[model samples]
Target: MYYGGYYGGVGGTWFLILMPALLLAMYAQLKVTSSFNKYLRVQSGSGYTGSEVARIILDRNGLHDVRIEQVGGNLTDHYDPRSKVIRLSRNVYNGHSVAAVSVAAHEVGHAIQHDEGYFPLILRNNIAPIASIGSRFVWILILLGLVISPFLIEVGILLYVAVVLFQVITLPVEFNASKRALYQLENGIVYRDELDSSKEVLNAAALTYVAATLVALGQLLRLLSIFGRRRD
Candidate 1:
């Protein structure tokens, strides 16, 4: 595995395993997302724009307090937890394709989560600042540990703890988003049959999160393994 054999003192085996796994997940997400976007227009007979669809879903949920605004980029839609707003990218906000509706519905799902107090979402919000703090300094800290201290293990431990915590928090936030997206779709909050491609769009987008989490996890494991062998 790490065959580093105390080369850096840690197996780094986790990286050996993780890098390919990370690539595999990314490939799956990329293919799924691209294909869904490509084929969705064919099934999108609804002709309803993303902004219109967002309005419908929001009003249905009595979420008038939340506003939808158009932003730039492809598939860059997201719910702004801080401002309680939904920002839909150009494609997601205006297109009548399945990709549009599915992404729009998924963003609204976050507003619903905000309203209902989904525990994981709430916990994720609370941890945001803490995680941000760690991520911002993680690389510097890890590198500093390696170069500055004979007690490198302790420094590495700190870095690993921060990284792992960030990864752990990320998992639930994504899983909940996908759950809410599927729930909204199946509940007839958004009529996929009208476009018949909404499900695929949401499914594809969810895979992005899955890819991200797995990649983070693998990297964390590799870091841990690397530091873990320091005493050897």
Candidate 2:
């Protein structure tokens, strides 16, 4: 059997290794969406549009050169460190809800990270291009390794390790960004309940990163196990 050749005696163990991570990823995604939706409906007392909040945060940090622009999509906000631009989704660009502001602030947190040369952020950026290439071809390399050469499997495992490291580094960068967002929000933009709501939103969003890391770790474990079995 092809499975016998590739996976050895642990033919079906991929399911055992990956199912928990897959489920966690799904739950994290659902929680982020639910949290965002809940806060999106709750109007903030500040009555400031998301772009306005971004401007406030950036200006307060002496990031006057950074520009905020509207982007089309849901929960697609990001800071382009290369271009020195912050792009917010339409709901965030125009809406004055806690979710909108919190998300915008979280993105601006990335701008702050860039400006301050945050270590993990810098490391993640340095690894991104290689990780991107690894992500695209790692599976193919693994398949070839399984079919052709045990040495190729080792090579694939090393490449996959790089991808996993990138994800691991990303977790801190994301969580720190959320932390910066909440810190800024607490400086009088939102009151007690509103601050709590923003926290919930940012926390939920951060889980998505956690989920990605877990998924990568699980996949790496599975690959290692399969390789071990193949060697045996």
Candidate 3:
């Protein structure tokens, strides 16, 4: 999830502070899109569809009960810890492309994290609802506080802190998942020569998470600065 919103007309130094992160976010989005599209057309040597690769990895890890389902949309693959199911986008589920398998394996990596009680994933899931609420209403509260009460602004800042925390926690989870995906793919599914391409896809994807964290952090700092100056 990306954290971003306008801070009314209040501008200057804080805006400058946020500029770099905003630019990085844009670059990250372009990088992931380009990498995914580029590799999506390049089929893996193993000829295993994304669903097939996910199934193999799941079963090998003794997660035979874990199920894989095809979902609609582009690059929407994810693992549902509650249902023990891996949901893949149509292309990733049926295509034999490097991008497809790499994405599929990355999602399976989440399932493995769930099974082993990975701390960051566990924490992330636990606070997901709070983070969701924070992301949805933080700006509203802050804007209202600007027009109404300092208390509301303080409350908004506190809520956004949760959103920022969630973004921070997500980094390790994604990085580890990509690492796991590389290991699984390298074993046999993806060719030796194709591994670098696979890494590119995963790394490009990881950059998005990094960008998100930076954006959240920058916004948090901006909020604090705004509040501080308001009191002055």
Candidate 4:
């Protein structure tokens, strides 16, 4: 029997490779929630709402033309480079808490990245659309390849690699953004005590990206193992 026959089998090599990634991803998600909740309760000494903090950072950086808008949903804050706008979630837009301020500043970090033509930021943006479309078709192609043609399996692997690459690029973008946020906050936006709390929130958020990258890597390894067996 071709080793491809064992594809998706339970308690095999696949299980060993995937277990750690799954665990890390779960832990990262929990930590992000915990840190966000904890810091959300702590108000900033600067008493600036998240929107105000974002506006201040943008203006100080000569981004006065950039617009700040309130967005709905939890933790949906983002900087839309195409729109040249920063969209803060409802809580962050009006709340004067450490969590709110840190998140607000982080989005502005992306805006800064765009203004400066950050390499990884630009690469990630270009890769995002391919990864998005590839994600939906990977499993289908893999399953079909298992029964039809090994060439399809190879295509699936290539697509999965692209996704992993996107995740890899995302890590630096997020970390740099978080670092920028902390540095900006430490300058004058928050008191000494509040600085640590903001760090905690950003650090937890960073872990999520780490976990995502790990998961993507693990999945790619799993696919290679399964498909390699068929070739052998």
TM-score of each: 0.82, 0.90, 0.92, 0.92
Tens digits of per-residue lDDT for model 4 on 23-118?
988999999888888888888889999999999999989999899999999989999988999999998999998999999999999999999999
Error of 1 at 166 (Å): 4.1
Better of 1 and 3 by lDDT: 3
lDDT of 3 by residue, 1-232 (tens): 0122234334355576578889999999999999999999999999999999999999888999999999999878899999999999999999999999999999999999999999999999988988898889988987887888778878988888899999999999999999999999999888999999999999999999988988888888778766655554
Q: All predictions: root-mean-square deviation over Cα?
A: 3.8, 3.4, 4.9, 2.9
lDDT of each: 0.69, 0.88, 0.89, 0.88
Q: C-alpha displacement of 201 in model 2, angstroms? A: 0.4
Which is the better candidate, 1 or 3, if ranked by TM-score?
Answer: 3
List candidate 2 segments past 4 Å from native: 1-17
Per-candidate clashes, comma-separated? 0, 0, 0, 0
Candidate 3, residue 209: CA error in Å? 0.5
- Clash pairs of candidate 4? none
Model 1 weakest 10-residue run by lDDT: 1-10
Q: Tens digit of lDDT per residue, candidate 1, span 82-173? A: 89899999887877766777777778888888888888678778766666666566666666756665265455556556555666666666
Tell me how far the alpha carbon of residue 101 in candidate 4 is from the true structure, in angstroms, after superposition: 0.1
